[model samples]
Target: MAVDIRTQGLQKPVSVAEYLFARLYEIGIRSVHGVPGDFNLVALDFLPKAKLKWVGSVNELNAAYAADGYARTNGIGALITTFGVGELSAMNGIAGSFSEHVPVVHIVGCPSTVSQRNGMLLHHTLGNGDFSVFANMSSQVTCELAKLNKPAEIADQIDNALRECWIRSRPVYLMLPTDMVEKKIEGARLDQPIDLSEPPNDPEREDYVVDVVLRYLHAAKNPVMLVDACAIRHRVLGEVRDLIEKTKLPVFVTPMGKGAIDESSPTYGGVYAGTGSQPGVAERVESSDLVLSIGALKSDFNTTGFSYRTSQLKTIDFHSTHCVVRYSEYPGVTMRGVLRKVTERVDVGKLAKQHEVTKVVNEVAENRDSSDTITQAFFWPRVGEYLKENDIVVTETGTANFGIWETKYPRGVTGVTQILWGSIGWSLPAAQGAALAAKDMGVDRRTILFVGDGSFQLTCQEVAVMIRHNLKITIFLIYNEGFTIERFIHGMEAEYNDISRWQYTEVPTVFGASDKQVRKFIVKTKHELEKLLTDKEFNEAGGLQFVELWMPKEDAPRALRITTEVAARNNAKAE
Candidate 1:
């Protein structure tokens, strides 16, 4: 006899706002981050009352970044904002989250259904009559679902939208019109539990891929392994690392996939495409006997628009879609299934490590620490030291763009970064989503954010969300004024590199992040910074601490130093 010990809830119908709000609790959302607007006041009303906190942001872009970062570290990040202006402001961050596959729920407030037909030129309406701009723009980076026309379908629409998010492992949006938030609706009642578990591979297709890949592997002598953000985000690091070890192939991580395997590992060949490339390594990639790109988007940015010619041998680009072999034999099948079958046949451990390849992996790590400032150099190593068991870290496009060169992590943990869609203000709210997801899954993990001052100002309002939910977060604000990275891009020459200086210490107080019991911190120097970061008072969970490091405007940490140096030279040449 077997017993089912499960928690049960009382069944009762709830209004659209109630049901949707309840679903947040069901999915384990503790707080909502973003600015309020007329269109979204319905959900806003119930948020505080129901014990779910609502955080108001100064701007939509930062709110989106906060939500994205919250999700990267916490899971199920939530952001709510008004119509056109707010939604449009959040575009950059939201799109980045979608590209990075960070699970987030963006609740955008829109004009009422009645208003859609009135032709009255609603307050938030764009120059064009179509409201689809919000949905369409988001659709490119991540998928979105919305229906302002149907009041009764609101709850169900939200439920289905979240379900699709689980399936795709990326960001999803649910547009809510101001009038429909409190409308009546029948909540979706599914008898079958939503399975978060991944399904087993297709046997036949699995065998086919393994056989084809095995044939290629056995023939190649100097095959190079390439992996990207997708592999890292899916928590497939171990499996991927296992495949690398089994084949004894040299591994090259993408900027986002830096820590999938310890950057210090003998098999590590540091990141390619973006980060510093070793002297002969870039050429090696070109002349590699076999190139295996697994779970890699091979985004144009990653390969310099696929610039390096690899015509001498072959490329086995393994993706969710059909596999492209040597850019010739394109076959249909899942890459994981292929790996599964291949593992069944080959004794990968017997592949014997390649000495020359191993040498390259070792050489790459030495060049990773490119940051010049000694005190400022703590970015990645400090990040590595702070790594917890399955801890979620949300990094914005700039921080993520530069890549945590000195950062380290365990074999298969999760992190979120906006690589393709370089969105500045996404890390914050995304961390909220990650926290929400973690709490729901009963996982004890802290959310951390590595962001700069110029970007941090964008979504400064999420501090309220942290306060309301009692979510513990450690946020780092490197106070170097202006858009640091953009200064290196050709014409700007630091012209647009300016931001209003604010007391970084006042963020928590201004946003009400400081309740009677919780505390916040602001550290300026190397000594004070290290003590605060390492001290007992600063690390406690549920405390919102801001360590503000005052650096000259020049203290910008570029992930790709080579490119920055080149840009500097180009700027000098022009002058």
Candidate 2:
């Protein structure tokens, strides 16, 4: 690719968009998810010319979710929006991406450098002293945040943003002032493997980790592997699974990390925290002598708010920091690098025998189906039936939501979730973005969306976009009257938890089709949901279709325990 070059004095500079996009191409990103804005005109101008498609979004929140799905599936996700209003709108989604350990680049165009120097009021701002304060607010949500303030500092600034995100493993932000774009600067070197810090580890914590892991490894009669989604994002699933397979440790997943290893494996203990989580899974973790938690977060939902645990005394918690042993609550070895080394020492033959034993236990749990009101007891296995070898699924947060659907994804199906944000209303918009990607990739597989009513309402407008493009998607909407997770919180049960209910199946026709294009279905019971999923009329529809299933407004699900725990902690922190 070649571009305009301008020379000034002896200093070297480049267009801000060129500098940023070059960094992106260097990192192997070819497509981005975003809605164009006047502030980001430079990107809008150059991205298409560089053969990058701007996957437009209906709203900022959806933009974040869409970007997240793209990045999660394809390895690098990008989102661009205008200044204050746009950035603020996207905060929640990007934060969720951060929580899920998705490597996403958020590029926002802001008031030009000169506009900042004028100190004049801009439209739709909070009247804060400095316009850059908006970036500070975004800083609270992103992993790394910065403003490209001067012509000379732009290259190093962009480089630092990419490098820090690469090093620390979280979302990062680059706030671009309009004027600084397209300024001639040295051809900024793109972000590469060579441009990062040494392993971010605390050398002082090595002994702490050494003692804890070895104790657990030796003491475990039935050790279990608790892998969270972060482990997959860190690209350590194979290594972690290798350790588990070698040691023959049974494995379980948090909702965020579902399907990290083949859930069908004999050693799989099943999902520990979600609507469809197996009962024995949690009890087994609590009963075990050791719990090897790899990249597993003790989130409110993922861990029942960390309320439940395996052997508290001998627990092995591996995260971004040191391996923390429960005995002293002290940091140990840098969990990332140390896990690589320790897993290598595991015994494969012994591990295989252990897996055989767990396989029997797993079969028993899988066979005990019931008609109780438990949602996980109801939906997950059915989800497993619908998935194909190359299907893609997107989930949104809500009551009786996608949290615990025991889905059996085919060999390469990508499961996308908003583990960090966990906010309702992300699925529909995100599914639209994912569909766009599927179209772009020319993959014939269908996209499935498991969404809650509350979340669907938030991003329902995007259905028109899906229909306009004739994207293939199957949406299973869980119809609950309110935010199911909120009711789990202590005092949010009454008016605050209630949400307006709409004619759910009528949504697709209402939003996506005129008299001629809309096709829809109403699923009052499980049978209807099953039929719609299987019937050719429903599945083969080229335009848009909606399937609505009525669910209890009050039935307690496992994720509720998680939400209650996390919400309380967050609320307490707020206080």
Candidate 3:
């Protein structure tokens, strides 16, 4: 009963691998990342025909992490891995992408369909002849799953999986068997690009939600807009910005939502994370009569251990899937449409007039100690001074992540972090991916990474990949002994929280870069860092630059101290 696709199609045929790669190219994935394996060896041959570049990574986990970062910057990304061992190695990275709402396509080159039907034992298999185990495990982390075993249905499955990955902004699992890679499918379907648009909201429900938002907006004497991580993930920055500009409401961002708004704007307020917020930010947000929370993910870290003082009755939440005005929920009405409609119809005069804006100065007191040691308070704001507009700043989930709250970003800068997932070793490889993505997009932006000693040691081998690709990135290796964040959370003097130190500034050279291709510096004092930050040649370096920033082991960011204290209490609390 199978109808051959060749007779049904009016045009030429292409191999399944060719069709899949072509689809990936059309969706703006210029670079595919993964480690090469025997199962995926033949399929990797079709990359060039589709104009895709295979970025050979050091390991599958780093490759998946890079893909996640690339997807965040380049709109969509993909990675290829072998079955069983290779796929399982990338699962942690995939789960992080899922938790963070980044769209990444995970393609696994599995054993042949024939091998599965005949119950033949394979090397990567469990030796029990069960081929469904890995796919079943991947189903837990991905939004869509596509098994391309049947030739006639392959094209639709590929397109559908990709479409869902884009719309939902989460990872998707695609299983490509070794034998099916060469199976012929219709090539004419490649002419039409995959429809990547989100489904439109129902007209009636959307209108009602917009009206309700407007009514509350006009009635409130004091209202504020709180932007969060999903605003960037869901591709609604334009709508959010339009609403912000038209209404001129006091805008604040959560820790996870950092860099979503232009911090240079007059309406921009500082970050508000309950008691961990900047000066006057908590009072301003908690006192507002109406809080328009956009795309909020109130994770424990994001909320500073759930310390938010604002009442839900006073909050109107706007999300990717639904809208809530106060306590009234309007399902199926997305924020993008509602934000657009409200921006187009908002009455600026009816909204409360702006009071004298209190400018929150984040500058810390200068180091008064005679040792001239760089403290966390002094280092972060100094980093803020060194940052340029449009730069992509990557922070590791340790002190770098918590310290960044005090470093206000310039206009157009994109902040990347794993605040919700709290993955320790994500920033280094992620920076590599972000830099490659920026280059692929042809944007003139510096890729900067701030990673602690412990996190850098986990994925430092990715520096070789960056060197091989000749990517321009600035990496500030914060040497504060060991896992400072974990030490603050528990076991301040415990041996388990310690790590051996490395001579970090020599990494680029060790990674096989020439002297001219790398610049290295070690700063142990405040004056040394300031001099390097102001140097024109160092700031505008042509190749990879490494800076080792030495700081006191006991010193931690104020927000980190607060959040860790709360976490320690929660961990020790009796059930």
Number of the predicted model whose lDDT against the real structure is largest: 3
lDDT of 3 by residue, 1-575 (tens): 99765656647689999999999998899999999898899999999999999999999999998998888889989999999999999999999999999999999998889998997988988999899999999999999999999988999999999999999999999999999998888889998889998899998889888898899899998899999999999999999999988988999999989999999899988898997887599999999999999999999899899999999889999999998887889888999999999999999989889775565647755533566789898888778888999999999998989899989799999999999987889999899999999989988789999999999999999999899899989999999899999999988899998998787888888889898888889999988987999999888857799999999998999899999999999999997
Please, what is the whole-model Cα lDDT of each candidate in the order they appear? 0.63, 0.69, 0.91
- Models sorted by TM-score, best on top: 3, 2, 1
Residues 92-198 of candidate 2 have per-residue lDDT tens digits of: 88887777777788999887888888866887467754787778887876788878887677777787888767656678999888887777666624423436543
Q: Model 1 RMSD to the real structure? A: 6.8
Off by over 4 Å in 2: 1-14, 188-219, 274-277, 326-333, 347-376, 400-413, 437-445, 468-470, 487-498, 509-519, 536-544, 552-575
After superposing all C-alphas onto the true structure, candidate 2 shows an RMSD in angstroms of: 4.7
Ranked by lDDT, top first: 3, 2, 1
Poorest lDDT segment (10 consecutive residues) of candidate 3: 361-370
| CA deviation > 4 Å runs, candidate 3 | 1-10, 364-371
Error of 3 at 483 (Å): 0.2
lDDT, candidate 1, 372-442, per-residue tens: 33243454556566566566666665534564544666544465566677656556665655565566456
